[model samples]
Target chain A: MYTKLALLIFIFMSKLSASVVTTLPEFAWIVHNLNPDTKVINLLQGNEDPHFVDASPSFVFKVAKAKLLIKNGMQLEMGWLPVVTQQSGNEAVQLGGKGHCDASQNVNKVGVIANYDRSMGDVHPVGNPHYTLSLVEMKSVIKTIAKCMERVGLEYSKDKYTELLAKFDAQIANVKKLLKPIKMKKFMVYHTEFNYFLRDFDLISVGSLEEVPGVLPSAVYLAKTAKKAMDEKVSLVLASNVSPERYLNKFKDISSINYVKAQMHPLSSDDYLKHYENFINELVDNVSL
Target chain B: MRLILLMFLLVTSAFAQNNNLQLINWFAGADIVASGDNLDQGADKENHLNDGMLVREFEFSAVSQIDQTWQGILTLAYHNELQAEEEHLEVHEAMLFSSKLLPMANVKIGKFFLGFGRLNRFHRHDWIFTEAPLVQKSFFGNEGVKDTGFEYTRLLGGALNWKLTVGLTSGGEFKHGEAHEEEGEEEHDHGGNPAPYEPTRYLRASNFIEFSTIEGIESGVSYVERRDGEGTRSSYAGLDLIYKKRVNQYIDRLVQFEVWQRTTKEMGEESFQDLGAYLYFEKGLNRHHGLGLRFDFYLPADLEEEEDHDEHGHSSIDGITPMSNYHAISLSYNYYNSEFMRTRFTLEHHNGVDVEEEEESFQRAHLQFVFNIGAHPAHVY
Candidate 1:
């Protein structure tokens, strides 16, 4: 009887070890893609702005049973994630716990503005928090996610995580190959969010609709930017950018420029590869438009 | 102090090297304001909360890791206009919060704001209007209640998934209530004591509920009770609701409502009740521009004293009663110069009806600006 009880306990612990939890939908995708058997509870939908996610009560319940929790740190989800996790009261999932992981910490953060001032418009002093959008940064972040899972004893299978990483690395390499035509090309974006993506792809942005991040473009500034763009043949526009899109519509002349757009994160995990593929295809389709 | 802070940072960073404790962010900010020359002091002449917005509020707040299981937050503040003196420094909040202390519960202790109604517990920098709501100022002192206490937040995970908080305070002193009195100024009795007193004990409890994130609906109810060694006591209960929706990428629509009731018991006086409520709406036009409007109404426990006494002790005016009430409406526009700097413009109209002086109404306009120095913590969603 004692032997049977010990075996039952061992089975229970192993099953518990396989379960994991993540905060954002992107982190959940990383986990699900790594181990299909692991249950992934994504707190936010892909289309929702992660910056202003709500700490809905449902998260508290979901996180309470989670064995591990992964998050996008660097104040990216500053508005809500920490607060909700604290309310979760799950020791392993709380910050600094064994099951806790801050995915951004391992990657080299870009767009660092030293001695930054808030007057710069909601600036992230450490750096831009959207490095997750960069393929190269994601490559580095992927390894960290795997290592964190291993440390927390949540790695479902060794080869499963490795296979997913290898496949993704190949896909990213192909994406880079497909973007050779847009390499060293110049364009204009709606927000500074695309800075890391452009840098990763060897592309450049000549100007932005709002040069001051987060601030709406003034009429005088817009006219000057348009004149400079027309003069320099910088008529390529990266629309559907993360920030406000209505600003472009206000200036009909500027909106007339060739527009490029992409959506890398979709709501459904099954759509992840498709969106990722479309993202690269869209860039290649309109890079020189 | 600088040396101490630097040493602390170095030690913490070194101590928590591998996934260790480190200072994530620290924010410093200053708030300054200037009022228009043409202003209305309102019917209650005693409410002179603003003179001129100067470099008034200087705040420094830091969040640090104490260890693997503990996180510490320290906030120090300095103001030029808090008292009769030219400059005053104070410790705004110092607390340790941990989620591992209890099973499925978050615990916090040390000096922190009470878990009061929505706006009352907000840091000074987080107020939506240029000035504190008249109800809050009259209910408590200029600064809301802060005390040494312990509190816990836990989810009653079930079908409803209700979040609950319970807290208790061993002792704390209420600010001198007479701060509102002035020689020639009219006084409205909002029913708080005019003298400072130490509370023998205090208790607070609250419950919060949030619906789907897509709809962005959150509601909470809070209750608080305090007692002095004497027979005096006060009990407050309030409900708050917030609705937010992303109308577009740049614009977010926010509507909030709060209603509260306060009851007091004195040694020899009959119990008194005061009621107040506020409705607020803000329309975000873009990432950096927003327009807001707020409406306030309250019925006070004590009547306002409008001096119309004849040579005799009796008053000359008629229809005077012991009950008083007030209503105010303010329209505001905010321009965020940057995430670090914010400028606000407010036009407020206030009126009070007491025993029987003509329901006096007046208007005032204000312009205020706040500039952040370092990393600021994110506000509650």
Candidate 2:
């Protein structure tokens, strides 16, 4: 009976030791990709906006058990993530520590609307925080995630992380090369979320339909927009899958413009590679001279 | 019903083609508020929608980017004052934007919300509260918050980032209301006389005023001085210093300070500019629940009052009049069921002190539940 109890204790300790924690969905993707053997508990999901996530009790419990905690810095999760970390009483994943990695660092963010204030309808006051979508940006984020994991003394499958990261880099480079040939590098987007992606790909984003982030446009405004799109001879009207469709139909018949949807946030199981491949393929398919 | 059917047809037609233009993102929400005045100044208590108290708003917005440099957004909204029995339905915002002009700068020349103060430029759907702050609402008025304008924004410097923005607006129209008169006039009064013989006091123009009446230019510069540290543990410190000045020839000089910070758990300091500065703090108790506290003190500039005669040879005081200094403290808790749905409860206290009268204190409690029906871009910053 003593031997059995000792074995049970060992097993429980081992299980507890095996747990790894990650902040932000991008880091979760990297951890899952790098070490399939380790169970990764993701603090945030892609479907929900990470900027204003509500910190719940379960989230604190998860943080307490985490050996590794990764976060997107640059004030992206300022609203809730800090509170969760503080309440968890886990000093391992504290800010400026090895546990936190802001993915926005070192990425060339283009078309970042400057002087952004609260009035601009929930725009990022800092540089673009959605750097995870760009392959070049993703590489930087992966490197930081790997470094954070290493700090926690967790053995990451370096071979797998590097392999996946290299493949993703090549895939992104190929897409960039493919897009280079297209003379019309200018496009329109529904919102300001795609600044980093557009900058990485050397694409120009001209305008947005809504006057502000969440406010709807009027018919008079739509008519004026249609006229502008026609006059500018805009090549593509870029939108996201999450945005609405009613207002975009006015430009469908216009030969000068083609509507394309760019996925700002990946909500599916597809990693960065699959998502970008699908995005680029859709872009090439829809956007043509 | 016909409009809804038309919208449905338009959406269906696009969806059938597997086109990007045919997406429909819709969201609807209502606010339930209860407030009482200590003075009991005859303010109505019944829930009425048109008075801008209890509101129900439905918004539908669509975005289709034509290409890299051009994009368009079309948004329509229906707002109703549930208690006031007034409804407003219109296509609120539709603009096509482009950034192909320069590498570091983007020029937006369309009918868009002119970037003004922090609150004026943001969308109501994304705000923590239904109404804007008192300062913004009282000063800018409703339409003054947005106008037909041209904006130029550009980023400069690498290591030390600096942003500059300049915009010109055609100014916004003021809400019209009839001037008060003595209670004795039966049929109509012209120039304070209860007789039709009084000549029309200098034939006034129609109710609709021209835009040139309030045309103005607003410009501002912001510097984000950030020092990158070892990681989040050391407390990523950054200073967002902004100076904005607007002049319209009518009245001038409005400035605001909006500074805050986020620190990691190890930093130990959660206070945001607590040392004689505007600040607020929000912390999550758990993944599903969070609490936020905000204390705001509005110190308006001193007023310069002058007594002047009106065009009709009537004597009246005309000039900058002192507005009440308002202090507000708000406590809010949020319950997030999912990304698209959430319930929030806010208790707010307002201490409004007029220059002459004693300070008045009021307490307001608001409960709101929002369920996003369609897809929208997540808040980035």
Candidate 3:
């Protein structure tokens, strides 16, 4: 009985000690795979919108106990993460802290705008913040995370990271082969979420359904987009689960261009690899060659 | 104008040199408003809501992570002459924040909004309604309570996600049941002004939880105490709650409620108390449109008595001036042009017993525009 009690206490104490906190499930998956023994908690759930998450108390609690915090930086989590970090009072995770990891530091960015302002409607001034959609960018983010984890004295396996990189390269090649038939296929997205994905697979993007991120398109804009779709022979309209259904339906009815729904982020890190593979397969199967 | 230009240039140069400093977040904003009232066409008193278009307020802020262990922020606010006798600019907040001073605690020093009730800590531009709630206006002034202070906050991580904050400040005089008061002047014994009792200390504890991905709830309790030069004392206690539901990316719902009570003790006079509360609800129809409603109720210190006598033993109470209850209701429509631009139209009705002990009512309609530029920090939930 005493031994059992000791073991339970040890388990509880381990949970109370510092752990890793991530802003998204994708980062959680990478962290978990990189160090299976490390504890990982994700602040954003699968269904929540990343652009406008509430600074919920649970997020502060998790961040407070975190020794390391990893975020897909380019201002993707700007709306809510700053509040959480400040409220947590955890110096390790605050901006410029030793334990803070910005995964976008070394990754190549796309959709960079010049002289950007809010008039453009929620434009990310630096670049598009959706680099996680690309496997190559994810690899770069993993390297950054590994280095940050080392700096914070968190246990990480370089051998495992090397193995993960090799696996990612194979998956990248597989994705390239899967989309070769539809390479350069013209398509439009609901948001700029898929820019990295499109660039990686050599796909052509005609335009976006949303003239500005987070702002609903007007009827006139939709009409113009429909005309552009026909003129450009756009084969598909790629939308996420959070995209407004009414506008997508209206655009489809007007242009007769089929659209496909993609679950942009995985719900669980346990099966993240499978989800990534299936995400690519779904896109290749949906687009007409 | 030259000073403003020079300040802007200096900030621009600093931003150009530092990659981590965020100059735009909460840096600049404009509040434009037009209101029509039934009280008097254009004879409204100074500082009272007028019947025409006006630039309400402008704000500029600069914030930076100074180092690995500290952050600094400075905000300057300029209000239209309607808010005062003369147009002027004020240093609204200049603070340094740090989390490394102590384990599991954050520290803030300098001028800032006290850690009080939920809405009191947020700036007016961040408020859901065009004006302060009736109760908050009477008890904490139009801008709510703020001063130079030192505050400590701790997040107690557990199932409930609790947070506790305590503050001490070189406080200012309480609003003492008045919506508008002039600087360096105190109105005493009109409707129970704790004119000399300055709020000097405060404590607030808050918590929040997510029921699901689509819904969440937050609640907080706050207390403040003030003391006068002559040893008069006043204490305020408040409770606030909020519930939010996200139906989709474009649609959401919010319900907020706050209640406060103030108890006062004079050197030789009988102790008295006042109570007030407000409830607010809002619904987002889509990304661009929303609707909101707010109801407010207030009762001054003489709720249990018929009148109040001055130190010279003369009765001065008259209807709602010091002895009656007041209620107001407001309905508003909001249009969000973008993340940084919003327009709101509000219709408000107020009812109360007048100085003549007769029921008096007034109505007003307000159109307000708020715009922001540069990077602003994310607001707390």
DockQ of each: 0.32, 0.02, 0.50
Judge the docking of candidate 3 as incorrect, acceptable, medium or high: medium
Off by over 4 Å in 2: A1-18, A110-116, A180-185, A213-220, A246-258, B1-381
Model 1 lDDT tens row, A1-289: 9999888877644433335656566677778777777766677666666665666656666777787778877777776677777777888877668878888887788877777654576567778887756767776777888888789766556687677667777877887898777676668877666777778767768878776766678988877777776766663666543545556765436645666544535664644555667777876786554
Ranking by TM-score: 3, 1, 2
**Per-residue lDDT of candidate 2, residues B186-251 (tens digit):** 322112222222111100010111111111122232221111121112111212222212121111
Instruction: Name the regions of candidate 3 deviating beyond 4 angstroms.
Output: A1-18, B1-26, B41-48, B66-68, B81-86, B176-199, B247-251, B303-322
**DockQ: the better of candidates 1 and 2:** 1
Candidate 1 per-residue lDDT over residues B202-271, each given as its tens digit: 3334333444455555677888777654446777788877777764333377887878787866667667
Global lDDT scores for all candidate models: 0.65, 0.49, 0.76
Candidates 1 and 3: which is better by lDDT? 3
Collision pairs in model 3 = B24-B374, B24-B375, B25-B375, B25-B376, B26-B376
Residue A277's lDDT in candidate 2: 81
Q: RMSDs, each prediction? A: 7.8, 23.6, 4.5
Instruction: Write model 2 residue lDDT over A1-289, tens digit each, in one string.
Output: 9999888877644543335665555567678887787767566545555554554433544655466777666666765676565544455554544554555666566436656644455455566676766778778777777776777776778689879878987897788777875646567766566666776777866677666664445677766776776676667777765455656776455334778767655553557567678787777677656
lDDT at A233, model 1 = 66
| Residue range B232-316, candidate 3, lDDT tens digits | 6778899999998875544389999999998877678677877889999999998789999999888766634433323311111
TM-score of candidate 1's A chain against the true A chain: 0.84
Worst-scoring 10-residue span by lDDT in model 3 chain A? A9-18
The share of true interface contacts that also appear in candidate 1 amounts to 0.49
